[model samples]
Every structure is written in C-alpha cells, then in structure tokens.
Target: MKDFIKFLRLDSLCGQLVAIAVLSLAALQCVNYYAVYSIQQSYASEFLSVGHDYLASVCQALAHMSAAEREDYLASLDRSRGALAKPFRFRAAEAPEWETETDYYKSVLAREAVTEILTRAGIPPRDVRARVLYGDSPEASEPHFAGYVFPMMQMLVQDGGGSWLELVQPLSVTDRRLIWRQRIFIMAESLICFALVIIFIVRAMLPLKRLGESVERFGANPETASPLPERGNYEVREVARSFNKMLARVQRNLTERDNMLEAMGHDLRTPLARVQLRLDSIEPPELREKFAANIEEIRSIVEQGLELARSLRTSEKAVPMDAAAFAASVADDMAANGGAVTFAEAADCGEPPLVAARPTCLRRAVENLACNALKYAGGAELSVERRGESVIIRVEDRGPGIPPELLEKVFEPYFRVEGSRSRGTGGTGLGLTIARNMVLLNNGFLTLENREGGGLRALITLPALKTAKIGEIRS
Candidate 1:
C-alpha cells in the first residue's frame, strides 16, 4: 500500500496530471447521474399535461349534452368493448397520491396546464383531482401509452349531468427514444471532455518529462553533460536555464585553476633551479651538502603543491570497475614501491563487486592514504569487502590514532598531524583532503576512525551504482 501511494505521489508531474483527470471525470459522472431523473421527468410531464387538458374537454362536452344524448355520445367513442370516459364517485378526488404536493414527478408546468384547462371548461378547482403513476404499479388505473409503458396520470371530474366522471390518460412525454438520445449525447459529451483534458495534461507535462531525463543524463557526467532544452513551461524553462548557467560557471572556475597551475609550474621551477645552482658553487663540501638538502626539501614542497592543483583539475571519467581488483592492485603497487602495504580480501569479496569510478584518480587517493600510513605506522593493512549494495575499502595502520577533536579537521587542506606523522616526514599536508575529494568525485565517501585496539583506519564506502558518474553531485 505504501509503495502504491509512493507511486502516485504528486511530487512528479505525471502523477499530478493523472490525479486531476480522474477527479474531474468522477465529478462529471456524478452530475450526469443526478440529472437523469429530472430530465426524464420533465419531458414526460409535458405529455401528462396534454392528457389532463383532453380529459377536461371531454367532461365539458358531456355537460352540454342532455341526459339521453350523453349515453349515445359516449357510445360513439367506445372501443374494445370499453368506455373511454367512465363515471365514478367524485368523493375520491383527494385519494390520489400524485395530486398531493409531495409528488416527485408533479411540476408547475403540469399543474398550470391542468388548472387552465379545467377553468376554461367552467369546472371548480375543488371538484377536480389529478395524478400520474408508473405502469408497473397495480394502481396505474389509466390508459398508459402502450408504446412506452411508462408512468401515467389519473383525473376525476364532477359532472353536471347527474354523474361523476373519471378519465385515464398516458403520460408518455419522454420514452426510450428520448432517454437513449440523451444518453448518447451525454456519452459523447463526456468522451470529448475527458479526451481534451487528457491531451492537455500530456502536452503540459511533456516538458517536465524532458527535464527529468536531462537531470538523469546530467548526473551521469557533469563534466561533459549537454545543457537541457529551455523549451517548456515558464518554471521548467527557467530551471533548465539556471542549470546551464551554473554548469558554465563551474567549467570556467576549473579552467582558471588549471591555467594558474600551469603558470606556477613554469614561473616557480626556474627560481628553484637557480638557487640549486648557486648552492653548487659553495666552497665547503659539507656546507654544500646541507644547503643542497634544504633546496631539495623546498623543491619537494613545490612539487606537492603542483600535485594538489592537478588533483583539483582532474578530468577523469567514471566507469564500472571491479572493487576487489582495484583495491588489491593499489596495495600491490604500494608494496612494489617499498611502501610496506599488505592486501586482504574478506570472504564476502568472492565475487568482485563492480562500482563506478575514475581509476587513476581513485588510485591516487588510495596511494596517498597508504603512504600516510607508512609514515606514521611503518606499515598498512588494506581490505576490501561488499556490504549489501555498497563496497567498503578499509586501510588500517597500527599507529597512534589521531585525536578525536582533530579527526574532521585532518581532512582540511594542508592539515598535518602533530605526532608520528609530523612535518619531519616531509608532506604538503593536502593528502587527506585530495583523497576525500577524489572519493567524492566517484560517488563515494571517506571516513577515519580509531580501531578497537590501537590504530587508525581509513574507510572508503562506495555505492554500487554501475552507471554512477564522476564529478557529479546528486541534488
């Protein structure tokens, strides 16, 4: 149930469109149903009024005839061995339910037509009674229009010829033909209305669909993503335009940083070379060695700064790669370089898990961590495993762990630990910062924590998304 509701959530444009259409259709159906009874009744009542008027005329004709002539006149209209107008007790004028105001089918039109008819015939209002009924009822007591077999009306008139008169007439105004005609009309109306509504909704939401696709494509690779079309509703077009502006700004900043790094590479290296040359001309051999070492230290710092800038301008693309193999290769490479790194694979890592990554940038991140471990702890233990939908890469070192307060601060650029991994080891201090940024670029995160015993552990958690792209953040 929750999943179904989530599917219908109005956060999406399609969901909202469907919801609105359904509600509108339901309301239309309700109104159509409610109007059915009234429309049918009104049409049938018009014919019912005609029947009453005919009955009144018959009574008026009989009143003008002498007692002897009335019998002969009535016989002239007889058919099917029955009289059309029959005599009855006028005392039952108030007995019919339809004559009462509570009658559903009774309307002002029927009443006015009947009243005018009776008055023109010189009949007192109190001397007449009229009602309409359905043919299915035993009390129909009228000549129902056999062609329709619907409801009917009854009338009783006081006769001036020493007898009471009663008349039966069919209230056959609206029949199957009329009702079916109305039905077809309503069906066509509803169909056209809903068709227009659905078409409008689809067209209106087309741009939203395009926007969603653009966002998905953008998140796949921010560096090389194409701008979304600025063709939609006002709000959607604005969003696309804003995203294009933002992407352009990011691209511009990255270009500027790269240019600065290139200029620094050329301008700073010549000065360092000139200083080394000057030291080469020193008189004492011991003094020359000391000065040369200091110069080398400065050169190393310069090189590290360049490397940090290079990390910032990294343009590596992401692709699916085996997590276990990647982690194993990083450790192997470090050990081959005499960095004292060892690799371990968890039992769960039997089948290599694939993750989206930029291999070169990701490798640099792990290398920096391993090298940092070697400086403080002399050795590093690396392990890779799969945990649910995520892959974990942990690098552990048996060194004095960083202080709790400085754990977050250690990720800041140029932040070096004060203990075993101090400045004496010669570092630019941007290792952790660069490593974390690289991990983030690959849709992963890095964290540091002290081991249960006495060591520090760097854990990299990468979500197992084969299509995950580099240099993109999920908004």
Candidate 2:
C-alpha cells in the first residue's frame, strides 16, 4: 500500500492530472450508460404503441374481406412490406399454441393495448387475444439479432366464420451488440483523448520539474549548478531567467566577502607578528610566557574564523571517489601524525562504495572529527561501509559521551559542553559547525550520537554513486 501511494505521488502535479482524468472518464461513462438505457426504453415503448395500431387495422381489413380474398390480400400486404420493416405472417388455424398457453405470456401492457384497439373497431375483446413470445421459446422459430433474443408479438383474431386468424410480428427494438460496439468505440476514443491530454500537461510542466531540481542542486553545491534553459512557456522562461540572475548575484557577493576576509587576515597577521617579536624583550619570563600564550590563542581564533568562512563557500568541484579508501587514507595520515587513530576496512563488496565529494572540504571535516576524538577520548577509530544507496563514514571514540540534551547544542557555533568538555581542551567551538557546513556543501549529512556503554559516534552519510556512473567517471 505504501509503494502504491508512492507510485501515485499525489503530492505532485502529474499525479493530480492523472487522478482528474480518471474521474472524468468514469463520470462520462456513467452518463453514457444512462443515456443508452433511457433511449432503449423510449424506443421500445414507441414501437409497441405503433405495433398495436397497425395490428388492429389489419384485423379490421380482414373482417371486411371475403374468405376467398383474405389469402390474396395478405400476400399483397407481405409483398409491399418495406425492407427495413418486419413482415407479419398471417394464417388461419383451429387453435394455435399461443392461444392454449395464454397464462405463459406475462406482458400485461401489450395484452391490454391489443384488447383496447380491437374493442374500438367493434370486435369483442373475447374474440381477440395478444401475447409476447421471446426468440428462445420452443414454439418460436425466429432467429436472434446479434446473439440477442427479442420479444415477438403474437396476435389472434376470430373472423365471421369463427376461424382463428394468427398473426406473428417482430418487436422493433435496438440490438444489444450494436449498443456495446458504440460504447466500446466511445471508450477507445475517450482513452486516446485522455492520453493526449496527459502528454500535453506533462510536457508543459516539464520545465518546472527541471527548475526545482536545479534549485536543489544549487543549494547543495552552487559551483556545480549550471544555468537552466530559458525555454518552454513564457512564465517558465521568466522564472529560469530570474533564477540565473539570483545565482550570479549570490556568487558575486561570496567573492566580495572572501576578498574582504583575505584583506582583514593579512592586515591582522602583520600586527600580531610584530607583537610576538616585542614579547621576547619582556622583563619577567613568566609574564612573557603568559603574553605569548594569549597572543597564540588570538592567532588560532583568527585563523579558525577564516577557515570557518571558507568552509561555507567552497569553490571545489565534486568528483566521485571511493569512500572506503578515502576513510582509510585519513585514518593512516592521523596515525602517522601520532594521533592513535585506527582504520577498519569494510567487508569486501562487489563494487567499491563511491560518493561524490569535494576532496579538500570533505577531508577537513573528517579530520576535525578525528582530532576532537584524539583530544578528549585519547584515540579514534575510522570505518566506512555501504548501506543501500548511501555510504557511511564513522568516527568512534571511547570518551565520556556527551549529555543527551547538549549533543545538538555542540553543533552550534561558539557553543561548547562545559562539564565533560572544558575550555582547557582548546577549541574555538566552530569545529562541528564547520564540519557540518562542509558536509552539507557536498550534499552529505553529519550527525553525532552517544555510543552504547560509553563513547561518542560521529557518522557521515553520503549519497552513493551508481555503478554505471562510476564506470563513466573512470573512463
């Protein structure tokens, strides 16, 4: 049921269009069926009325004719019957089967109509009888129309000689097969129209879909978001034009901000360098050491502030890389630097877990997590694995885990846990913030959770590249 709902995607425009089309078709079919049924009822009623009048006239004409001329007159009338009209077969008999089975004919309307017409013509109602017979009856030899049985009217009138005049005529009614064929044709036509409408609507809305995808891509990595084509309807084209203009403005603003930060860093570092040189000439060694420590802290803060700004607006182009190999490389580099970081290889899968990432930015984010573990926990373990369409990179430590409430607060810039994690550990409080921004820039997610027993787990989830795309990249 969930899969079916997902497939419908009623949240989207295309799904709404399909739903509307189906409902319209259903309503139209219902109207069509009612119209066909009403028309059949009206036509059948009119035919029966005309049939009663014609039968009565024929009986009256036969009453006036001599016994010898009656047969000749019937023959002439049969010959004059139109091709489209049903022929009335007349014969003189003692007692027909229809007369004996009077109770079997259950059509009260037809019998009453025949009796009324005969009585008005001066013939006694007792001398005239009418019955309806279906084509399937044993006494009826008439063939069916398109495999459908129709009722035939059988009438009997007693002449002056007391001989019974038997008349059998087919009821004028619409064929069931023809009505079904018309319905089938209408349904086919409606389906064709529905398909054409859906195609037109989808094509018209295609530009909107592309625009939404472009916006999402720009949010993930502005550098990789290309300008959308200014085609389709006028409104769509205008929206694309506006989006392109916005992208240009944002890029310009980022560039100007970077230039301003670079200038400020250069100007501040010059004065800080001069201060370091002057600190060496201080009288007391302890006072000089304290001054030097403060200056170094200031310098670290300045550099980290610049690094945080850079992480938000990376110009690095993302490329597909093996996540397992990348995690291992980071771990090996940290181990070489005497950080006590261990690399755990993932289980051998048929294909390497590949993710699209900016190498420098992603590496810095991973390194920040590892460094935090090494500072507090004294050691860190790095591992990578593929789970479904995502590649997960985890940094685990056996440190005293953070408080549940403060776990999310640590990600906020300049916010630090004061209990387990103190200011003495020395962080500008922007490490997690910077890491999260960098991961988001690569369209990945980073989350911190306390491990079982005692420890903290830093997990990064990146979208895995398809095997086909990996082959294209390698080629």
Candidate 3:
C-alpha cells in the first residue's frame, strides 16, 4: 500500500498519464455495470409477466372442462411436465441475485396462473407434479393424476422437508438467442465506456502535471525569464497567474532595494571626501595629526562600505574566457600592485576543456581571495586546474584559519569572525560575500576549508564551458 501511494506521486508525464487512465477506466466499468443491471431488471420483469399471462389463459379453459376432459388434460400436463423448454428466449441476462431465469420462471408459476393453466389445458389433479427449483433449495413435488391438481399447488405441504411448486418450463430456441445477444451488448458497452474514460482523463491531466512541474522550476529560480505557456484549465490558469504575480513583485522589490542602497552609498561618499579634505588643512601640531589620521580612517571605511554595497547588486552576466590566462592576469596585477603574489600552476580549463566566464569579474574575485590570504596569512599559494566540468581556483595560505563554525557564516554580509573587543582586521568583512556572489553569477561555487597544514584554503569552481565557442574564446 505504501509503494502504491508512492507510485501515484510520480510526477513524470508517463506516470501521470497512466494514473489518469486507470482512474477513468475504473469509473467507466462502475457506470456500465449499473446501466446494464437496470436494463436486465426491466426486461426480466416483462418476461415474468408474459409467463403469468400464459398460465392464466390455459387455467381458464380447464375450469369449464368436464370430468372426462379433465382426465385427458391431466395426461397432457404429465407428459409435458418433464420436457426441456427455454422459458425466456428474447431476454438478456440479469446480473443481480433476483434477475436470473429460475427466479422469474419459478415465482411466476407459483402464482394462481399455474393451476388455472393446467385445468384449462384439460389437466386434472393427481396428474402432474408441481416441481419448483428455488435457487435457495431443490426438491421435486409429488405427482397427482385424474384429480383436482389446483389444490396441490395451495396444499402448503412439505416434500423432502422443503416447499416447491411444479410447472412444465421448457427451454425454447429463442432463449439461447437472447442470452448471446445480451452478453454481446453488455461486453460492447463496457469496452466503449473504458475507451472514453481513458481518452478524457489523459487529455485533462497531461497539462495539469506539466503545469505543476513548471511551478516548481519557477520557484527554484525566481530570476528565470523563461515564461510558461498560459494554457490549460481554469485552475491551472489561476496558478500561473499567482506565480507570475509573485515573481514580478519579488523582482520589483529587489530592484528597488538595491537601487536605494546604491544611491545612499554614492551620496554619502562625497561628504566623507569633503571631511577628509578639511582635516588635511588643519595645522594644530598634536590635535591636527590625530584628527587627520581619524579622517583618513573614515575615508577608508566609507570606501569599503560603498564597495560592499556595489558587490551585493548582482549585475554581472557570464561570458566565455580562458581560465589559465585569467588566473595569470590576476597574479600579475597583484604583483604589479607590490603584493608578493605568485601562481603555483596554471592550465587551460573549461569546454574541451577551456572554462568560460565573465573574465573581469572572475579576475577580481580571484584577486580579492588572494588579497585576503596575503593580508592575514602573509602571501598565498594560488593554483588553477580543471576538476570534472568545472575550473577550480584554489588559494591556500599559512596563517590561522577561521573557526569551524564561522567558516560558512563568513559568506554572510559583514560577518567578521574576530570579536568586537579585539583589534579588527583591515577588511570590511564583505570580501567573501562578494566572491561568493561572483561565483554564483558565473554558475559556480566558492567554498572554504581549513588546510591540514594550517591557515585557510578557499576553492572557487566555475562551470567549464563545453561548447565550440569556449575553445574559440580560449584561443
């Protein structure tokens, strides 16, 4: 039962199709069975009524017969009683417990028509036995000859400890024809109903299942610009409407918030710059030196703040570039900036297998990570290599690594590991955040781990560009 429920939850197109098909087929079978049952009941009742009328006509004639004529009638009833005849030739088979031939034929004969028919047919009592084979029990009634057989049916007597009414019910050729005809009708209707159900359910559920998947994908990446087809039933349309509205709202709010933060950072920088200029002109020997140093520190703080804010705004779109050359360029740029930066090794990565990315942003991200290592750990080991379908740029330093708990949290904005009481590092605590954002924008990832030897190792892996164009870019 648990496995069956799990199968129903499978969201594949084929699975959903099968589920709908099965449900539809079952419903059709139920409806078809009920319809055929109703038809059987109507026709069976008609058959019973006809049997009763036939008995009535024969009994009426027997009532006026003389005693000698009644003896001959009884003789005829006895001879025909054992004959095999089809009672209902044109009727279809009934499904319910009461809809069978034994019920209709036996019950109708037990009515007043049987005796009247026997007498009308010149049959007398003590001539023929009234044998009723009730589905509930089976026993033959006693035979009477040359006597009033009408009283035998009403005797209420028990034979073999069970009650029975005997009548001659011979099966005719028409009975066989009706049986075959009814069977074919019921089977044909059942098959047609099954087909209709499969068709209806498959058509309806196919789109709904696809729409559910589309909603999942949209939720996974709200920035995805691929639009879903606005087609299907009302419920699907309503769901799509809600999804699109929520997506638009999220995009709008994020855009507005980023714009506000960027604007504020830009506006505040000019005032900070003006304050620095005023402090530099102060000439008090002792007071001026302290004030100038404080003003310069404020300027640096403001610059870092603005840089952090700008990095948070994810505006970089990825493009193709040479991983080896990009890594080399970063190291050389730092070397030119008077930093002791050196590349441990470099190789072509991405595609077959030159990795593609936004060259400038990736270069800046690698440089920032290297800067962090050099600032705290005093120089670093930087290496670029292909790892499966990604380019892994690793920077390992010899200085102390962050605590284990703080490793993941370091990516959060302004999450400095050092306590407030300690002398803080020069960084504004946004370098890792910027690097992570850049990696994500390039369809890559950045992870930090404690080196076995000592210090921290930052690994950046970006998707390797596998297409022909990546090779061209690398060349």
Candidate 4:
C-alpha cells in the first residue's frame, strides 16, 4: 500500500486535479445516500394517515358485531391474511420497549392515534393500549433485511375479555433492491463518464508531451534538431513558439562560437612555429628541450581545444551498423599503430551485433577508452557482448585503477588525476569528456569502474537498433 501511494505522482497538476474531483464526487454521493436514508427512517413525523384511518374503521366495525359474528369474521380474516384483530384487556399484553429515537417516535405516535380513535368511538381511552412493532419472520431473517424497519400496528381493548388486533403493512423486497440498483447504475454511469473525461484530458495534453520530447531532443543535438509543431491549447502553442525562437538563437550562437574557435586555432599555429624556432636557439641543451616541450604542450592544447569544440556539435546521424565488428576494427587499427589492443568474442553470439549509432563517433569513443587503457594499464582487452536488447563494449586493462573518490572526476574536461598532468599522459584531460559526450549523443552510456583484478574497466552500452534512415550518415 505504501509502495502504491509512493508511486502516485500527485506532484503533477493533472494527477492532483483528477484525484480531487473523484474523491469529491464520491463524498457527495455518500452524503446524498445517507441524507435520504435518515429522512426515510424518520417517517414517524409524517403522520401515516392511511394506517390511522384503517385502524379506526376496523375498531368501529368490530364494536357493532355479535360475539359469534366477530369470531367467524376474525377466523375468515385470519385465513385470508395475517392481520390479527381482536379486543383484549390492557393488563394481559406484552409491551414493547423502544430502543432508538425512531422506535420512540413510532411508540408515541401509535399510542396517540389509537387513543383518539377509541375516545371518539365512546370507548374509554384509559382501558385501551396500542404499540408499534416491526413484523419479520424469524425463519426468514437475513443480514441484509434484518435492520429493515417496517411499521406494524397493534391495539388492545378491555371492554369484555382481553383481546388484540394486529395489522402488518406488506413490504416488497424486490422493489427495495430495485431502488439500490438504480442508485448503483447511476453511480456507475457517472464514473464511466468521469473516466472518459480523464482519458480525453490526457489525450488533449499529448501535444505538450510531444513538445517536451522535442525540447530534450534539441538539447541533445542542437545542430540537427527539427522544429516542434505549434499545436495544442493556447499555453502549449505559446510555449512551442517561444521554444522554436530560443532554439534558433542557440544554434546561431553555437555556430558562431565554433567558427571563432576554428579561426583562433588556425591563427595560433604560425605563432607556435615561430616560438619553436626561437626555443631552438637556447644555449643549454636541457633548457632548450624544456622550452621546446612547453611550446609543444601549447600546440597540443590548441589542437585538443579545437577537437573538443568540434565534438560538442552533435551533427552526426546514427545508422544501422555492426557494433562488435566496429570495435574490433578500432582495436586492429590501434594494434597497427603500436598499441597493445585486442578484441574478445562474446559468449552468446558469434556475429557482431547490429545497432544504430554514428560510426565515426562510436569508433572515436571506443578508441579513446582503448587509448586510456593502453596508457595507464600498458595493454587493453576489448569485448563487445550483448546484454538483452543492449550491447556493452568492455575495455579492460591490468594497470593501477583510479581512486574510488576521483573515478567520476576523471571525466571532467581539463581535469587530471594527481601526478598525471604531465606530457607523458598524452592528454589535455578532454578525451574522456569528449568520449562520454559522443556516447550520450548516440543514445548510449559510458561508465568506468575498478575491475576485480587490480585494473580499471570502461563499459559503453548502446541501445538496440529498431529503425534507421537509409540515406548517407550525417556529419
């Protein structure tokens, strides 16, 4: 129950509104039902005129009958119906005690109605008594109808020998059930309508949902993002219009930024060449090499900055390609270039898995992880394995693993681990960041963790391919 409630997203305005509406309707329905019921049970105040007149007439007719005629008429009436009618002394009767407010009302009203009838008939009222009770056969008792209070009338007389007359009003069990059935049917109809309204409301908000998706897509790939439609209610339409305007402005800014970075990098090459020539003229050999190395670092930084800037633009489009085969090729290329990289076969499938990814970007991310493994662990093993609908490419090495605290920090741009910031590391600290960004743009994830055997492992899992465009890949 707690889990169910925890999962309920009442933070959403739509969910909160629907919950309030349904609860309010249900509370109103319950109150309406109870109000009607309380009023029905309080029927004693309404003065049941039909029952009062019938009881009076029966008493007047009985006063005119002879003893034998009264007995014969009563016998005939007993055979036809269960309405018991006779006169009895007031002392020889069982009095019913009223337990509830409704019962007390019935008792008081029955005594008053009976006394008035007898006094008008020239009979002393003090010698007469009346009581109201409910008639239900013990054999036919049921939980549902046990509390069904049906009114019954009983009167006693003490003119001669004690006797009594009882009149029980007939009740229709089916008719009582029909009243509840009608109420239930109405409630069911109301709930059905409410559900339909909820469904329509959700469908009507679909355009807003689509707009959210478009915004996220643009954030991921601003260069290649398509414009969202100006469809939906007024608020959604306004939001879409504003979002399109913002998207266009951002794209223009990014294009300008990329162009400026390229120009700056291009212009720095000449100054770097001049500095390298100037450093060659130093007198001390060691100092000259050190200055040349510093100049080299500057050049490397400029080239890496340009590469990182270019990678930030996610213009590459994904297509269906062999993911495993692609990783194997990267390993083969690194091996050819004097790097110790080799591919491993998956235990499941012999064939490389086909996935939707940009070949250049995907290869670059894997190549970066492989280079990290070779540099830190001295050698690297690459494996592409299928894990259900996704494919994971594992890059493992047998070198000193990163500190648990600084594992995530290694992926930050321009961040270097302690004692690894020199030219020996062969990076300006943008490799992992660029690789992770490329993986993310292709709808994949990249993570690093310490392998079990004193080494680091990098995993890049790509989502399974479903559909792809048949045209040439975007770059």
Q: Each model's C-alpha lDDT?
A: 0.71, 0.78, 0.60, 0.69
Candidate 3: clashing residue pairs, number: 34
Off by over 4 Å in 4: 1-7, 10-15, 35-50, 53-73, 82-103, 113-163, 169-176, 179-183, 186-248, 270-295, 336-338, 349-354, 385-390, 466-475
lDDT of 2 at 126: 44
lDDT of 4: 0.69
Error of 4 at 257 (Å): 2.0
Pick by TM-score: which candidate is best?
A: 2
Instruction: Quote the lDDT for 184 in model 4.
Output: 85
How many steric clashes between backbone atoms does each model show?
A: 1, 0, 34, 6
All candidates' TM-scores? 0.60, 0.74, 0.52, 0.72
When summed lDDT is taken over every stretch of 10 residues in candidate 4, the lowest stretch is 84-93
- In candidate 1, clashing pairs total 1
Which window of 10 residues has the lowest lDDT sum in candidate 3? 150-159
Error of 1 at 101 (Å): 4.0
lDDT of 3 by residue, 1-475 (tens): 5533443465755457666666766687667667656666566545545655554443444456675675566466555642533332111111212211333444345444445555555645422223334223322332322222211121111112122223333222234466668668767866776666555655665566566666674453344334556567787677767766776787677667767766877787788778767875777768878877676666666666666655544555556766766777788888888887787765443233357676666776787899888888778777878777677888888888888888898987767778531225666677888787666556567899999978899998877776766556556
**After superposing candidate 1, which stretches have Cα over 4 Å from the reference?**
1-99, 102-127, 130-226, 229-242, 280-294, 314-319, 336-352, 377-381, 385-392, 396-409, 417-422, 440-475
User: Candidate 3: misplaced stretches above 4 Å?
Assistant: 1-237, 280-286, 313-317, 346-351, 419-423, 468-475
TM-score for candidate 4: 0.72
Compose the digit string of candidate 2's lDDT tens values, residues 264-344.
876889899999999979969999999998999889888877877687776787888988889999999989988999989
Q: Residues 288-357, candidate 1: write the lDDT tens digits.
A: 9988888888787777777766665467777778778888898998889888899986786444577877
Task: Name the candidate, 3 or 4, with the larger TM-score value.
Answer: 4
Scored by lDDT, model 1 comes in at 0.71
